[model samples]
Target: MLVMHTPPQHHIVILGAGFGGLRTALELEKRRARLKDFHVTLIDKRSEHVYTPLLYEVSTGALHDNQKFCVGELCSGVAVPLEAYPQAMRSKRLTFKRGEVTGIDPKKKEVHLKDGTRISYDDLVVALGSAVSTFGIPGVNEHALFMKCLADAFRVRQRLAEFLGAYVEGKEKRVEIVVGGAGPTGTETAAELGNFFDRLVKNGIIKRKDYEIRLVEAAPDILGIYPEKFRVHARARLETIGVILMTNTKILEVKKKQVVTDKGEINADVMIWSGGIRPLDVVKTFGLALDEKGWIPVEPSVLVKGQKDIWAIGDVAAFLDPKTGKRVPALAQATTKEASVVAENVTRRLERKRPMAFHPPSHWVTAIPLGGAYGLVDFGSWSLRGRLGYFVRKAADFFYFFSILPFGQAFRMWLKGTNVYIKND
Candidate 1:
């Protein structure tokens, strides 16, 4: 006699709970009525889904609840619980399991969890997101601060607080904050730190020259991908606020109190590494071939190449643009859109309908918060700057919150974020 094992058996098992994964889970459940008896299981190690766009604020201490902030309210308010999904609560079809994926056996269609439990699936959606890439720079993994997740945000906040406090109390001669990387993360963190330092000056805590920030980038120019207009505006504003632009300066190594660069060594009371992101190691366990960048190659419809029922999306997927033949940048908009495409494709496949090809936007909007009160929003056709641009950026945050949360909860979360982060401006 043969016996079938129980899954909490699911037909579709989505991995990771980031924007791509969480949205995929909820959207699939919305169409649960079509799947008949088949169920969807979404698994992740963490309980909360981090909204990364606001993590810069967290690092700058804007998300602090009070003197005790330390990314408390923002972590909870910005990152909603996985169990908070209304669909998962109401439907038996959608299930959220909190577990870390250890390995995957593609031949058996099974996912092995950290706790030694195995889950078999007919179709698998891999949305495991990216991690900060040290790029093998010496001492970066040991001495530099990262801004990838909530825990990183908290570490940055606490470490900055300790260093800044030391400077304020006259225990340190001066503060030197070096942001390594000229990308959005590095630029934003440096610009926001300028505002925080200015506030300290206004409050008589530190002199104007007591603390300095240097933004180092190996690239020739900052915001290299943004249009000339946005880049010019951001560079100008950052300089006006005393953030030293060190473009074309390559970071060679990180020391305890200094950064060794191709140009010269610079003192670093705090070093923030916003260099880049890479796919997690878990992707390798799936027994799938990855592109040169360690991201899986997928069809235009996002089905993994050479894999029968495995689909890849978000940072883990090397989704290409038909026009440019370049992989889509791991922007938030593209990630969320990938969620919709994957959700629809999977549901349609289950319904015996053909999957649709994904056509992402030709130009992705770029939002750079220049400082506490100022921002630059580049819409490709036109752009906004100053207070208006900042408001637009904040509006995007609210829009994202509303998209994922119920109205009341979203409103409360938005209110909290706005209240805490407004002072950042």
Candidate 2:
């Protein structure tokens, strides 16, 4: 009789547990029964996965009923613990590892962690995401606050609270929060400050005139990527909230208390940068082709251009959308869809099946909350505005949490967030 031998189970490792990575994990977990030949390990520096859409909401403080959540409370609500994914926790093949990656040796198919541990993988997924881009602007790195993670949001709130207290004590005449971007995050953040400051005014904590939210943009219009109608509504809502719009104002430098712009210099008590993001430096060492922005260029199948078993997704992957003939935007909705492709492709390759192309929907539902009970949701061919739009926005948020979390937990989260957001008007 001929001697028989079994092949060792293949290992799949995913770096970063952001939207794409987490979604990919869930996708793989669902296919765990069929993926008996493989096992997946998700690695991240932080154990908790942040639900990023509500980030601006956390920054703006209590938007409804004049309530306020401390740094811990806000963070707890937005950041879901890795253990929350009960299905993934039950998957025998799926495992979570908490470690900061120090190096990647693609030739060896190994990932080096900071704690002197080395993990070898048969397949790798790089979804490490991106960080704020300062564009070599002087003082930006040293002076400006970023809004990338939970800690960053906490710091912003702390600084704003300190500024408010100083103003009330007559130590400062005015407190200016300069937001250096007009994208969805910056726009929503600036807009929502209306209700937060209004609550302060109502409580006699600070007068309306004591604080100013200055939203600066280098572009000619705010929400530059959205349709004109959406921009019009957003602009109208922002004006109603008393947010100062400084369009076509290029920030030459960011200082401790001032933002020097081509349009003029503005007095800033605090500068928050939501300007842009660039890929992490670790990708350069991955032996992958990086675009001009340092993002890894991936094929239509979402595989890293040069490697067979390596894939990249989310903010780190420069995936061109065939439908638009442009690179896909780094949105949570888009990332989840991309995760589906990566998961499916991995299994397909293993089974000697054909891989599918990366085709995302033309209209990923985007809801921009423009303060209070107002929001704008774009659904490709049509859009919704006002109360209905706000409802849809919250609903979209609901579905997202529901998709990743247990039904009961998902409902509780949605209820809590909706209750606070609905009463904002």
Q: What is the C-alpha lDDT of each candidate?
A: 0.83, 0.81
Judge candidate 2 at residue 417 and give its lDDT.
Answer: 58
Candidate 2 overall lDDT versus native: 0.81
Which 10 consecutive residues of model 2 have the lowest summed lDDT?
1-10
State the TM-score for model 2: 0.93
List, residue by residue over 88-184, the lDDT tens digit for candidate 1.
2466677778899888889988888888878888888999888899999999998999888888877888887787667757788688999999899
What's the residue-level lDDT of 17 in candidate 1? 91
Tell me the spans in candidate 1 whose CA falls farther than 4 Å from its real position: 1-10, 62-71, 86-89
Best by lDDT: 1
> Clashes in model 1: which pairs?
65-69, 372-425
